[model samples]
Target chain A: MAVAADGRAAVAQTAVAAESRAVSSNEIIAEFVDVHRHYKMGDNVVRALNGVSMKVSKGDYLTIMGRSGSGKSTMLNLLGCLDRPTRGEYRVGGRDVSKLDDDALSNVRGHEIGFIFQSFNLIPQLTVLENLEVPLFYQGRVGAESREKAEYLADRVGLGQRLAHKPLELSGGQQQRVAIARALMNDPLFLLADEATGNLDSNTEAEILDLFDDLRPDGVTIVMVTHNPTVAQRADRTLWLKDGEVEKLVTNADRADAAPTEESL
Target chain B: MIRDTWRIVRLGLKSLMLHKLRSALTTAGILFGVASVIAMLAVGEGAKQDALERFQDMGVTNLIARSKKPAETATSNSQSLWSALSYGLLYAEADLIQASLPTSVVARVREAKRPMIRGEHFHTSIIVGTEPSFLELTNMQVREGRWLGDIDDRRLANVCVLGATLTRLLFPLENPMDQTVLIGDDDRYRVVGVLSEQGRTAGAGSTPYDECMFIPLHTHQRRFGDVNTTRSGGSFSRERVELAEVKVKMPSSEDVAAGAQVIRDLLAQRIEETGDVLVTVPLELLKQEEESKRMFNIVLAVIASISLLVGGIGIMNVMLATVTERTREIGIRRALGAKKKHVVQQFLVEAGVLSALGGVVGVTLGVGLPFLITTWFAQKTIILPQHVMLAFSISAAVGVVFGLYPAWRAANMDPVEALRHE
Candidate 1:
């Protein structure tokens, strides 16, 4: 009872199977496909990112490793919806992101994705508590809910006693922790960390990583970009990028711990 | 939205508070501009009232009819400086008008003089003759004794009414009412009445009511013997009479025009030449003065408005600088989901509030200055009408016109770019 199948039909069957894998897991919270970000500087065309594609899943702590000019920050910008891809189909939670307008992208950043910068981009004039409430202010979700959420985050970030203090009054680690608490205030779908531990000491970096570890099991997806191998090793998966495109993708087990005091790659 | 605006306003206020000196300097321009407009307007109004009151002191609604010199007549003789040739209103003419009209009052006036009379115990005195009705004509009131009457005129009596200044000169220490004073040869005149003090008319020196004597008109005609006229011709051809004044009375201000028209018509019918009578009506002059005062007030208001406009420009300048200084703040507000309209409104309200406060101060100054000027100086008071809402309203308008540019700049900031700004 052998029925010979046509070559075209067999090829089509494999194509469907590959297409299934494209959206295989509802776990794929965000996807970047052949994204290019080109910027014009005077007469020269600077390719900030050259056709980079990667996927991040729910509860996945992924690290993006690259040198200074390797477009790691640009990748984080694309993920955080702070910037749009020059060309490519970028999707977040099964929604096509190329079509999203600037305001919509901001909304997504404000609601769906939270960002933490190494510089601790907290408004220096505002108190630590007020800094945590900033993203909520932009979300137009003011009142008791936002206040309670800010209070809870202040406690979680170990800045409960320093809530009334301004960013300038806090140390590097404290300010970065305040920024992290601010980023998590809206219960965002993913946390996009851009060199979050770059300015922190080893002990403070380990503490921040431990905070992230506490957040990951709560179903908060994390995508961290860093040049430090020690920071990258804390992630569940590592994507080593060179000149924008992914050179290799490895698991946390494959990324051996580098010297704690070693210089950032 | 209100909460956001409140925050922004608080921030703006904080920044302004930070640079207290600069803000005060900026506000100083507005203060000076506002205060100047108010003070200038008040002074202008006071000056106008001073001029008006001077006119009022002369007379409110009285008519003055004076005689003009005849066109054909000329005074070639140098001895006729005190007396002038007249071809118009005569003594008989005044009598004629009085007898015919059913008016409120009438008075006959004539001029006469006597040789200088000196008593053994007194100094030299100058005497002039006029009728008893002259007391009423000059709006005079006797301070001490009785005025000359009909019996005095009928008997050709030499009873006299002395002015307050003249009484002080003739009698010195004695009561002059019953005393006899010598005039010319073999003639003695009895003093009758002393008039109340008559003040000076607007810029005119030596009011006639101050030092003149009043006698019967008949006595004057006889005493002078037709020598009052400065004749330059043969006996039958010489023009007669010097100066004679006529006063026309009306029932009310509304009837002034009617009274004037009647007098004009009557004079036109009686006189052969039109220029014989130079008629002056106080009511008409008063109206013309009022119209000119209105024009003066408008000019003053326009000048004052320039200061207000300058104040408005000051507000605009401050607001524009504020927009530039708070560009980052504006950017932050825009990135925080504030619409362009919201941003513009916030700035506009801030500017409006600033100017409105300035306006309030200006209005107080405008109203307060006049009272202060009057209290400090012996001057006529200025009156501001209910329609002076322009003081505050114009300042507010200035705020709007000047504030628009800065507000528009603030509202038009791009959120994406603004959020990226440091």
Candidate 2:
């Protein structure tokens, strides 16, 4: 199955049919095949993820939805190169991410993915513009260029007027905007948001969700984790995670026409 | 890395500024430790230097022979008495040594009492009768007129030299040069010169050189009988007047030991008698002073080092707290491609800056403390040597050694976990 006309290249010896596939190509951006993740609590070991496998294609927006402790966050961490799977191969853009050292993993994270946390993990001491400059500093840009890029990003995020304000001084919605701007500074290939709007009210969450919706037209790939169906409904596709494995995936079409409510599902 | 260091330094200083009271208290520890080191070492070094200066003033290589007696019968009280009775150097003994040894100058003193007067002022003084060479041998200087001549000693002229202070006291307004001052009952001696005043010896109580009067030895023997007494086979007999104080001068002070040895050998051959003489060497005292100076420096260094240790410990404690406080910051830098060495260097710079600042403070306090102490207590001013600076530099090095571990700990923190921390 050639996923031609797509930006990614995928090579698999065996392929399984995924239901309601809307992607025109079989291009693979990430592959977590037969991955297992475990944790130890005192004497007994508990499995956080059990034999879970998934793939994402180029320019694909994904949503991994689950309740607390369903391994959604753990999967996100693995996808972001923050943690390693206990078993099986994990690949990001066809590179074996599982084999990288701590330094290399950090480099991979810095270069390959941009992370947005729920609490807007902007360094509180820095201003909105400085927060955007942080990743640029890590990327080894000089002061003037980094500043110019940060200012441009701040303007793009609609935070030009509030660049001098600290994260603590900003509203929750504004703070998240700063985080998103910071994430985009290095022009990372993948954007991973873990409950990015969890701390915000519905109005702020809706605003941030609209911002995520706005990013799609630019062809930047995104993956977000959310428990709320309303929030997940904004994504092009949603993967329902149960007990650390992918239970089902739903397309926006299935969600729009006669979507299953909580009781019906 | 340089930019990172600058950023860290700016951050550190800002943090310090945020906690003003805490920073002050920590800096105070460094200040006191440095100040105490400078002050203590300065005092000790000053005392050692004072001793050496005094020793050098006394002449490093001169040999002095004070009268001494046989050890067996000499109790502490009786030693002086026995030594006085021994009264070692006879005039002939000095002449014999002078002829036998290749020494520079031999000064012979024959003691006699003479009552001298100028107008109505009469005072009994120890009239030291000696040769013309005595002036050089004793290291005495003439303040006015001239020293007694060879002709005066040979002809036994009735003339005397007054010490500077005595001359001042006797002749208040009028000049004493070429004036007659009576010696004994009928003889009137001309005061040809005044000797320069030498300060009082700590060993010789209240006996300053200014109180003495000098006359020809042959003239002294003609007037007063003799002061030398000797014993042979338990029988007391009058001996030709002995040399009261025999001062032997060499070409250099370093030759004093060899000169003493030669003098002893020459005396042994001429005397033909045992247990009759004693030799006391001031050069031995000089050696003892040198040894004491070494011991003094060691003690000073030990005391100074204690304060330096305290300073180093203070730096370590500050660095440890800094490491703990900046754990997350360390994680961020490490994640941003900082090597372990880079992280270590950031913290080491902080500590190095601290100790280097402390060193500057130490040097300032070390320099100022001496003058301050002198003025406050009205004591002698202290002199600090170049080696004190060397010790302070070592203290800064100690700061670096002690501070390294905490910096390493901060540098080695796990980035992922640190980022996860609230």
Candidate 3:
């Protein structure tokens, strides 16, 4: 928390440190161009995010890693459409969203971005299937068709038999699976996970990551924010943030065909 | 839209069901409020109905003038003791009143207390002297035999009609028809008719002819005379009263007021002198009763509304607490794409469902409470449809109205802060 307060002056120098390094022809689904988010805390202005740029493309898996003061949470909030950048621009599906009003931003969140939280934030009052229906419900798409879709997603997460169970009744891993199924309800452009395995045991975290891996062939895009290096290394590429700015971008060396260029395909 | 509302309402119900005891206690507040409202109004309506029945029994178009023995008559005539003080409605006044209301029926009545005896059955009661028109004016019908006719009055025959209750008191077992009752000393009047039972409550001036004996007007005048002598514990008194009461029946209900005014004007001079003749107009009393009833209903509504307001406040209190407790849930919903209005609607619908449930049960209890009152308390109760509707709608509106502040607070909470709420 104190690092975040002291990092305000370092934002300017680190802002120019990193940029997208993927040499692929995949279509861009979402992009952030030099985004800055500033808040005036009493007498001090806290620069949470300063001049950071990144891109998420179709069929790609990327992770954002930073210390507590490195704007990891802010990046998650921005990616989820829960907060807008104070300067620069955020685009989803090639349209600028930072200037949209609350309702319109909420519409973008419902239709484009899917979020998975560290706490597996499924509404406890709702059953697994009902939790899966939340995203579509906001779009007024609840009916037999949505219910069928929910059943299909629940089965995909291996929770078909637990559709009627409340989130509180499920284990941390099972609850996170429900959250994942819920995210897929809208067929979002990409999944934005904020420390998705922060509350899980090692065994469950590996299982959930494998579930993410299984969706890769289906052209599912993902953007994750985590502070754990082991979790970050599982992604195709890792973007590091320091002092509210991207510090470096590293492509995992062990992953074969790390960049799926058109020529390689 | 209706389907959407119904869906929201169903969801609200499920959420409320999670805290069953809390919801039930909140509902009790409204239940009792609605119950008391219906019950109180019912009691008021019942009292009004009772009064209405009394006035209706007295006959709306009829004006009664009863003879009262003036206090002055007692003071002045005490010197003589036996001079037979003359007071009350004079036979002359009856004639004048008959002439003025030419289209009306005037039944003049005279009362003579006498000991009448039949086969081993003897009692002392008032023997009423009246014409044939008395039956029609009093709304009394003959159950058996025949009522006295004009010929019986002209001949001064000793024929009488026994009141339904008096027949039981005097005759007991034997049929009163063709029987004879001996009045005073050697004055025998045959019972020629029996009146149907009149379930009227006797009012002031000793009315309700059910306990009286009806005889020919001339027979009473010829045999008993105008003077009534009484000797109580060696104290002697004699009073002369030509008529006991005069009932004037108007052509219709609308004519009662004008007819009463004409009669009042005619007797104005005599009333000032003796103050013994009191005229009773029932129509004016009925109108006054109507006005007072409206005031009573208004009072009842105000009282009922206050109770419902208290109930509404109870709902508001519960909803505010529920919103505070569900802050994290609101944040989760907002993160999952729920808008501010959605959060507000969710809580508002929950409150509405709570109160509407109370209304349903409240109506059931309110409707049944009157029957219990009639059975256990023996109090008359009338349940009005509009009252039920008013109470139910008000209860529902109370939920929505009281829920506004809490729902707005929930909707306006900062999502970022709420998400971090433990």
Question: Best lDDT goes to which candidate?
Answer: 3
The TM-score values for the models, in the order shown, are 0.63, 0.74, 0.88
Cα deviation at B241, candidate 2, in Å, is: 8.2
Cα lDDT tens digits, model 1, B1-422, are 77766655664454566557766666555555565566666666777676666556545555556665446533424325554444657776676666655663555555444443436544333344555555555566889888888888889997888777767766677888778777667677788888888764521112355566777767766766544543366432334554355665555567667767767777884345546776777768777877887887788778777777777777788888887767765654443334566667767877776776677776776677767777888655554553246566777777777889989987776543544455
Task: DockQ for every model, please.
Answer: 0.08, 0.16, 0.42
The residue-level lDDT of candidate 3 at A38 comes to 90
Q: Who wins the DockQ comparison? A: 3
In Å, residue A168's CA in model 2 sits off its true spot by 5.1
Displacement of residue B94 (Cα, Å) in model 3 is: 3.3
User: lDDT of candidate 1?
Assistant: 0.68
Per-residue alpha-carbon lDDT of model 1 for A1-265, expressed as tens digits?
0111332243245335434544443458788888898888999988888887788887788888988888886787678665688889788877877768766765666666677777666665567777677677765666566666666667667776888897899999899888888777666667888789988899999998988888665566788888998898888778877887777777766434543232222
What is the per-residue lDDT of model 2 for residues B170-234, given as tens digits with 9 covering 90 to 100?
78888899998887577888998998776634211134457777888787777665545555788
**Model 1 clashing residue pairs (backbone):** none
Give per-residue lDDT, candidate 1, residue A27: 59
Report the Cα lDDT for residue A120, model 2. Answer: 78
